[model samples]
Target chain A: MKTLSLRNLQKTYFDPYAGSQVTAVHDVSLDVEQGEFVSVVGPSGCGKTTILNMVAGFIPYSGGEILLDGAAVKGPGPDRGVVFQSFALFPWKTVLENVGFGPKMRGVPKADRDRIAREYLELAGLSHAADRYPNELSGGMQQRVGVVRALANNPAVLLMDEPFASVDAQTRMTLQEELTRIWQERKPTVIFITHDVAEAVFLANRVVVLSKGRVLDQIKVDLPRPRVWDHLMQDETFKRLSAQVLQMVRSA
Target chain B: MIASGQRTGSKTPGSGWVWRTMNSLAGAAVFVAPLLALVAIWAIVVPLFEVNPRIFPSVASVADAAADSIRDGSLIRHIGASLLRVGLGTLIGVVTAVPLGIAMGVSPAVSSFLTPLFRFFSVLAGIAWIPIATLWFGYGFGAIVFVIFNAVFFVVAYNTLLGVSTIPMTIRNAAASLGARRWALLTEVLLPGALPNIVTGVRTGLGFAWRGLIAAEMIATNVGLGYMLFVARDFYRTEVIVLGMIVIGLLWLLIDRLLLVPLERATIERWGLVRRT
Candidate 1:
């Protein structure tokens, strides 16, 4: 059964100063099943992030509906956790505090929240840096904290917008691996957005190609799980899937 | 794994609060040393020039006057009066202005409508209020405090409004997504995010208020630092005047360095886009 569904989703922004109405996300439809990892890949200005934002309920959709387990989303809530591209961990909060903020907001006791945050931080291999502020961490570590912050709530769906796009290639690969490991362990339905086709193929159960505000195609990755990074580039199936998605993206 | 290992792992340097504070104080002393040297030069230069006592008192004579005031308890009374007026006026101004600013700033239309109004008042803050204030309150503590209040109010309000509005929308959105209700959003996100600006506003507002307080005391009040200095001028008591001036300068420096600067630094370091110096 689909855990999250987007039906003919559309987003239109009217720029008053420019006096023009531009549609950011034109009619796009997709379904994400429970425990499934879906990556939305698109060119610049294609509005893949807009779709993710809609799922996260950060903005109102001009047309169509977003449903979680057949219930329409009203606005942003703890049920759907979003990880932004800029690693929007509250700078004022310590790593543990940032991770535990969702639970604290839900009236979770301080001790319990700390334990949960620490557990997630350990999973992200950031247990030692729990008390440190966001500014003290590197870009990669900060993003790790961002991911755990969203996951600490045990949300039904995880919405990520180019989570690793800002990091260096080496750090990106490491973060991608860490993310996959956490997702496997936690089993939250995730909708990841990225412009990198290779990253989309590497981390997704299914890669949805988007172009000019529409989904061009949804390509399923039948590659084996516990996908190792060192061997991924060598695998015939991984290479084929990546090449297909890359071709679709380029053609668009 | 390599990246994680490279992340300044485990042994976080400068971890303890006491050590960090000591480090900062040492840094502050470096900045303060130059001012101390200027005082030393003043002590030497005035005596060497053999300047007239009525024109500019020597450091020794100023010290003697300060000692005399301390013995008589008038110096304490004047300082206490000035501090009380500034403290009360600033407290009232901050309390009222912050909420009003936030209310106006929350809406684009309201903020734009009120921007010019606040700008006009902030420009006319401090000394500009003295004439009307004295006329209304009749040359006493009330008039002096009113001047200080008027000095701080508009500037703090304007800054608080700017602070609240300048917060990035993404941070607010992120907070909302994380299950923050209205009150939580304001206290947790909005307040903390705007803290740096609010602190800056207070600092600037207090500066204007301090000057206004002194000016108002000189013109209208009978028991404050400014009044003491003004009264000393009638007797050609340059020593007393110099003593009063030194006290004012030292007090301002102490407040700015020990209190305001540290507050600004901590807030900006914690939540602002600007990094620590």
Candidate 2:
């Protein structure tokens, strides 16, 4: 139940070899209303990840401000949960414990957190894997845990950074469907970052395409609810929007 | 009758564990057979050649020496003293090294400053410390323990730094994003991520500690397995010398196999942090 705003965000870092400051994310501004799903998609080096990283507070922005629920962002905190490209599940912890970690940090009692963890696991259809370690699961399953782990924390906005990129294609499709189902069920505020054009269009209510660290365009998808690859694969609007985003990305 | 017997066998308690235990016993036998054969050859060779006891005691004589030491309780006292020194030294080494290692890991400046020093000492670490250590502590428990501590400290600290620094950045980011504040991040992410390397460091460092302890004991202590061997040499009690040598070898083997290997394999492999060949 929060709105996130990024105002003229910019990132500049000195390249060691170049020996001069280079801007990674140019002045890009966007706003995501409460419980809205937004996808920021672009080619590599387009600063899509830089934007997410700055929003997640994993790195500092050189200029501009990020506000979540009207409060300015500082360093990393529990309020902004992130799903990494690498899945980043703790190898030593069981799936249940990983999901419960954020709640534990909030000092939720063991029983209460366990309940919370169980609920999230069920939401992700991972209840059976609750006791298993991350390494014991497949890459696709691991990322499923990764998504729910971020969600269970009840962050103001969830930031996902190309989370499904490492998995196989079939699994990726299934995961995309599962994610949409979970999103529709929970209606959490999300800012999902990906480079895949079709994925950006398919998953989001609004798609923001970045080109050369700047906002190239923002396309709002009017596709009907319950978006599934099965139906959307042949849907004319889905194909049109996807082609439009893909054309922009390729041109950029 | 055969079918009934099969049913009873299947119902037996811990059948899987029982099979596993049997497999381990067989594996142990396979490993020990060669060592036992070497011992048998020694037993035969010494008496058959009428080798001088001063040169090397017969297996019977060595066995008798072991029995005598056991009966008099000197062997236990010597072993107990050596173990205590090693345990205390290693304890201090690990406790002190972990924090310093973590500090260096978190800060590049600290690690860079101290890393060259570590590289130099890693080579010069063990027995070489004894002369200076004895000079400082004046030839007693302090000096010997200092040598053991030096042996363990450098390796564990260096490896711990390696461990902490090698942890994937994404993992740390995940923890931070998940609401792990500074202290929680240290205990949860950093510690667990660095565990496998830290365990390896302890194993290698303990090896160094054992060798250093013996060498230090020979020079700086009046008691210990090393001292026992040295005194036996002075009297030409080859039996006791042989006994002490065997005991040192056996103790190290026992510690490695029974404690270190299991610790590394059990927890680490279960976590899938390491793969066993």
Alpha carbon lDDT of residue A132, candidate 2?
A: 80
Tens digit of per-residue lDDT, candidate 2, span A149-204: 99999988889999999999999999999998998998888899999988988899
Docking class of 1: acceptable
Best candidate per lDDT, number? Answer: 2
Interface RMSD of 1: 5.0
Candidate 2: Cα lDDT at A62: 97
Report the poorest 10 consecutive residues by lDDT, candidate 2 chain B.
B1-10
How well does candidate 1 score on lDDT at residue A87?
87
| C-alpha DockQ for predicted model 1 | 0.47
True contacts kept of each: 0.64, 0.84
Best by DockQ: 2
